[model samples]
Target: MPLTARNPNESENEQDASQSGDEKPVLIEIDHVAIAVNDLGEAIDSYRESFGAVVDHREVVDSDGVEEALLKVAESYVQLMAPTRDDSPVAKYLAKKGEGLHHIGYRVADCDEALERLKSLGHKVIDEHPRPGSRGTTVAFVHPKAIHGTLIELVQE
Candidate 1:
């Protein structure tokens, strides 16, 4: 039975793995995990000193209200995200959650296409359209409401 019809009492549906029947191959890969912190410079220095990893990219995503420093790890990245504005989500996260892992990002060939596919499969999304992201990429956010309790991001470089 399809997931949507499996349990009427369930508040959510699973990922559309069934779409592979005719869809193209999986073109996305886990890109990075973002951690929201109160201090960007301190986090960067700590990671470098403890893990021997250097910041590969750093940028402020004004739209998302975050300043990020990315440390490369094999094919993925460890993103240190800090709020650029007092009212940004990261600021709120730090205030309420007190600095911790925020979201997981999946690298895609086409962010717009991936977001469209996600929406078609009934996933709740934060970004109805793709937007500029840190590290010179395009990105979109998938709402946690649809993906268990994890917030997901689709990134295209």
Candidate 2:
């Protein structure tokens, strides 16, 4: 049975029918799960010992003041992130929240569209526009307060 995807911005027949219930997932896939830690090396070592996961990509996103190690797990990644500077957001997050799961990256077909959808639904957005993310993906962040205290990243892979 096909379920109607009602969009107030569109006409009744124009409403998208792509999503017809739980039969189809709204997001493409789980892009990565980011964990903010005090020490990237220590976290990487711990994952290596416990799960034998190895770093597939390592990048220091100077713009975000974070050094990240991407450990591949199937099609997704376990992103181990550490702060590079005192004023970095990650540093602030760690200071306030301590080392733990930061934000979840959910793969999307179109980041701009996803962002618009969230905004249309009256959700608070951290990034108003899609920006460059690690690994050449375009991304936007949906504010945690809007998503029940879970930071959501819309990733266009």
Candidate 3:
């Protein structure tokens, strides 16, 4: 499915007509909401105690230098991440923003296609190509400046 360039002046019906019947939607769903924390274990424990949430998956991504705990929430996840190294992006985020929401992961049919579509629309992207993400997913990061200050991760599982 191809991503349609949206025209602000077009009506809802006109926009709908632009999409072909056999084409898949560009965005599938909200994959997860990532939170950067000071301690992964502490954050996991807190979620378990407060909301009865259990960690569904945990992994230390050496490439990103961060450990993450995924708590299943419906078809989505509440991802809690902590840095494994001082120079990691998560570590820098923690040093600057303390503990809070980091980025949002959006499930897409194809990371490459989504990236191309975003680029064609003149949106700024952090990753020029998709890379391996946690849980064997293909992902790419879109710059926050292009999405109203909210960092977006396009995830293809």
Candidate 4:
């Protein structure tokens, strides 16, 4: 039997039937999972020992007040973030919330376009404009206040 509609209550025709062709995923894959930690080295070492993942990239982004280590996982990465200075937001986050996942990043085709689309849908954004982020990518943060407490980062590589 073909995939036919069984229940009349299930509006099959109302679904997006036009989207049958293989549409590539808008967000290719998770760019990274950023974990804010007080000690970057320790965090990296711990992850290395536990998961056997090695750091592929490391950089100190003074603009963001963070030193990060990227651990490659297939197409994605694990970004271990630590404060470079006391005034950094990551520092403040670590001081207040201890150590854990800080934000989730969604890879977008264009940061500005994604942000604009989000704003059109009534979502509050933090970065009104795209800003230079770590790893040479343009990024923006979406305010957690509107998204049920999950801080969202939009990245364009």
Candidate 5:
């Protein structure tokens, strides 16, 4: 049976997946997996030489004070990012955690609605609302405290 067409007790958000065949708020494709690196160039070259992952997109996001290179991986992307300034959050993250996995971006149909749902669920959020992201996408960040140590970026393209 279709998920929403069933008679199970659920809030609107719970049944939203079936309403539009959208899977679930958190059930979208892994849009990208971001990693923090000291040298964005080196990381990009390594991915290209070692894994043959070519750069699909590269942009310096001034708002975030970071430069990122998106490497196409099937339908997803391996986002290699580096801070452009010492005050950047990525720099802070690297200082605290060193170079490694930074955050996971989960593609969402509606970034605003998904963020509202997360708020309603009492999750801590970094972005109070959707903001412009690289590659012409809208995105928001859910604080890592909300889901253990895993920082989440909800992306809507």
Candidate 6:
């Protein structure tokens, strides 16, 4: 079934059937709120001191030239990311926009399906297919231009 908004008045059975079909709800929950920073350690420290957040997972994504520190927040995470190289996208983003909100990662049941559904809806995508992401997840990026300047990442773990 194609991805569509559930009717507010739909019966429980109807809602279940729609969601349980070939395509499920694209978004499960907000996996993380990504923040781009100049210094990952400093950002981590700030979160730690300010909000009692601690690093749950940390990884250097060589492909993206970024090092990320994931701080668990409830069922989701606050992902602090810094560019490992000056040429990385995060670095460019920092140079242009300064340290701040970078992207939002939405947990999905199927990354590939979510990506495909977005494409079929005429949304611009950065990744044509799902790729390996930080923390052992399958992920794909949808272009910011397609979503009112907010970069959206579909993450499946």
Please write out the lDDT profile of model 4 over residues 41-152, one tens digit for every residue: 9999999999999999999998889999999999888999999999999999999999999998888888898788778878899999999998889999999986899898
The segments of candidate 6 whose C-alpha lies over 4 angstroms from its true place after superposition are 1-24
In terms of TM-score, which candidate is stronger, 3 or 6?
3
RMSD of 4: 6.2
- Minimal lDDT window, size 10, model 4: 16-25
What TM-score number comes out for model 3? 0.87
Off by over 4 Å in 4: 1-25
Task: Summarize candidate 2's per-residue lDDT along 18-49 as a digit string, tens digits.
Answer: 43322344588899999999999999999999
TM-score of each: 0.84, 0.85, 0.87, 0.83, 0.84, 0.86
Worst 10 residues of 2 by lDDT: 14-23
Off by over 4 Å in 2: 1-25
* lDDT (tens digit, per residue) of candidate 1 on 32-112: 999998999999999999999899999988877999999999999999999999999999989998999999998888899
How far does residue 154 in candidate 1 sit from its true spot (Å)?
0.4
Ranking by lDDT: 3, 6, 5, 2, 1, 4
- lDDT for each candidate structure: 0.87, 0.90, 0.92, 0.86, 0.91, 0.91
Q: Pick by lDDT: which candidate is best? A: 3
Top candidate (TM-score) = 3
* Ten residues in sequence with the least summed lDDT for candidate 3: 13-22
For model 3 the local lDDT of residue 59 reads: 93
**Candidate 4, lDDT over the whole model:** 0.86
Per-residue lDDT of candidate 6, residues 63-136 (tens digit): 99999999998989999999999999999999999999999999999899889988988999999999999989
Quote the RMSD, in angstroms, for model 3: 3.6
Supply every candidate's count of residue pairs whose N, Cα or C atoms clash at under 3 angstroms.
Answer: 0, 0, 0, 0, 0, 0
Model 1 worst lDDT window (10 residues):
7-16
